[model samples]
Target: MEFGLSEDQVMLQETIRRFVADEASLDTIRAIADQESGAQNVLDEKIAALGLDGLLVPEPEGGSGLGVLDAILVQECFGYGLVPSRFLANTVAAYAFGASGSELAGNIASGAAKFGLVLNDVVSRRDSSGIQVSGTSVTGKSLMAINVRDATHLLFYSDDAIHCGAPDETSVVKTIDRTREFFEVAVAGADPDAKTADVEQVFAVASVLIASDTLGAAQAMLDKAVVYASEREQFGRVIGSFQAVKHLCAEMAAKLEPCRALLWHAAHAIDENDDEAITMAYLAKAHMSDVATFIARTSTEVHGGMGFTDLVGLHYWFKRIGVNRQLFGTPMVLRERAARQQGLVA
Candidate 1:
């Protein structure tokens, strides 16, 4: 089946593209990454200024009450710009709370308390509690955890409900970005009142969002590679003159287009409440995870050694895709789920 974006969807994509071009340019993102400071809050306000925060929440929750497709659009743009904010976390949590009939929905819709959804295997079966979460906030020490350092409320899951202290320097471990530490949060006594039953549902959205982000990052890498191939000289002619380069570019596009179609198919299925949504969502994520990683790596190949340096910005997307792949669930895990659904045995 052919999938295409509606006129409204096209407009949304364009608006977001313009915003990223104007506000979160390569220079801007580089500056933020360089400082090791959290720019998610600042960027979140900018996105709020665009009125995107209300897209996923219900009308009763002070939002525009659109749907997941809108959220997918925002997710795509966020990936394109590499804005490391709690937007994804907040969106999923707000939706989960709305699903659970919790008062937190309103706060989430208004961006009052930042919500970071934790979907790691270590905590997937756990329940929420009042304990403090002391650890890393933004960097790799948290290993794919989003905006953990700046989060005010964390939607945590585990074998049972437990409390974790608020994150701080001592609790988190330092990694790629020093200012952003990944903390190993410890949980304490159960608090039934603090737990919510919406963890699985929220995780579904988180996985989908991460997949969408990877899609954007992959597109960026492909675009860069194509441009470099056409402009860079080898021996006496452009590298684009080589059949090998042409074939690689073709392979990149081949991987990207199908992933895009699968993504929209999954997003639409979920929005329309179709039974096929889950299967499609997992398939899309798994496929995109591989494609995003390949695009990043191959783009570096197309650009030669120049791509490895920070000046090229190729590594940023490469690293981001690597981290994104592991979040919610790895590509291998999603593929296994999809395969099982298809009744394919290993």
Candidate 2:
């Protein structure tokens, strides 16, 4: 069976790659890193123009009605650019709602609203007064939410359902990654009755998209490291000619390139609703998380002192991959999940 991307998919990836290369370069990422509200109107406009905002929405919802594979492609490009936008939250929410056949899914696909997702596992129950969500709010403290300020609605998961609420941004954490922003939102209450029974599917979608993003960043870093090694000369010749530098660059490729196939398999499995989709997605994420972390380190080490400096701008990709690795659980945790699926562990 052919595993490579189709012509259209390849074109789509190329188009977004060009857009990121030209419009959302490292310099642009650096400029927006320090903002309190990381909402970029122009970035959103550009994405909307391409109809990327509607990529995962079903056809009846006024979207392109694409599948997980398409979204994964664009997200990978977003990773390569290291562009700080609300794309992840937007796409994931659309995927969740659309996949579950929710009415709210229609609105999002039509570009009527944007969303932010806080991946906290909240407990919920129905009570005499109404639906209640525990740990949704406590002394105005909540888990860190990505793109909370940019979202019109805040989504939280509880009891296999998704609840929507407005955000109270009293305090937002200064996370390690400057290219992206996160907020610990204080919500009034997440309506437990809002939406139900596919939170696991949504989390699966989120995990693959994130893994694709890290893969992109890792690829970019490897490319930069290889180019630099080939150009930068030492006492006698270019550093890449040396065994150590060549090995570092080669190892990065060996680790990162194979990861693309796993990501592709995971995305395809999800779209096909294959039996192994969940386990495959987890495997892709676990493998990429570890690979990305290693590539980030090796890529930087390849650059020598320049890698650590902001002038080279490699740190943006470095930190971005690091952040992605932490999200959706660590490599070891995800590996354990994957292993248990195959009856490899107790």
Candidate 3:
């Protein structure tokens, strides 16, 4: 009946937390962001050294074969650091490929290949953009393909099946969040084999991971706001002494704390293959999106004008939360999906 992280889970979280603190500090992330190439390569090396590249892959595939919850913990740490890496996309890809018994899963687990994700069409397809599969050729465009930089393979949905293909031509898409990269990929005559995995299960796993990322980012913002309030002074008194600032920080903590538990439960549901796993994933994503947005805004307000400045660097977490809200599905879209799953909508 223990409703919390196990001792090993706590240790795992702390290990990644320390690594982020030492290796992916704000300055370090800024330096990597400014680089033109080899940035992700460096990160991949570090992650592989930590044996994190294969966190979700099966043991037979050289991975630890951990569950979704363990992956969630690692992703939360990445979010807190705002580390610009493809851990999110790669983890999901590993799960998908592993579930389907794809050979590429071993490459991913062994760090021999990187997998990018182009499943936006699965959530909400745009008439103007999508991957078209014809025979052995895949053609068309995906406006928002994630982790495409330096990816050796792309997982996308086409012709009512999940297809893995090598990216043909890709262009970076600029966004407010610089911590992660987005690309517009043009698929042309790539691999045509459709891997067999539960599409709904993959989507659910992706949603929970995204929600966990936001949870970590929100927690970072709240911690930063608290630290800033305790140090910054107004009218010869620290802002932390003010009831307004205290309430802002308190509200952020209160709102963000529950999200962690919600995400944990949702992730556990995925591992257990519970009947409500899909519904819980949708609900967790929707709730975290809304609450994290509130915490991002309130945390920024607590820092005043400095929050918007580069010196404070609060915008990194803020922008991360913003981008996460739109990824996969927005709160409104996810809420409707949850309703549909629960038979509350026609």
For model 1 the TM-score comes to 0.84
Where's the lowest-lDDT run of ten residues in candidate 2? 122-131
Instruction: Give me the displacement of residue 186 in model 2, in angstroms.
Output: 2.3
Which residue pairs come into collision in candidate 3? none
Q: In model 2, which runs have C-alpha deviations exceeding 4 angstroms?
A: 36-39, 120-141, 191-193, 339-346
lDDT of 3 by residue, 1-346 (tens): 8788889889999999998898787877776666647665776678768878788899998888988999999999988888766777778888888766777778887888787889878778778888888877777998778888778888887766677888889989888888777888986565645464477788888899989888889999999999999999999999999998888898888888888999999999999999899999999999999999999999999999999998888988999999999999999999898888889999
Clashes of each: 27, 0, 0
TM-score for each model: 0.84, 0.90, 0.95
| Model 1: per-residue Cα lDDT at residue 69 | 71
- What tens-digit string does per-residue lDDT give for candidate 2 at 296-338? 9999999999999989999999999988887766777777766
Model 3: residues with Cα > 4 Å off, grouped in runs = 36-39, 190-194
Model 1, which residues run further than 4 Å from truth? 36-41, 122-144, 160-170, 173-183, 186-199, 339-346
> Clashing residue pairs, candidate 2?
none
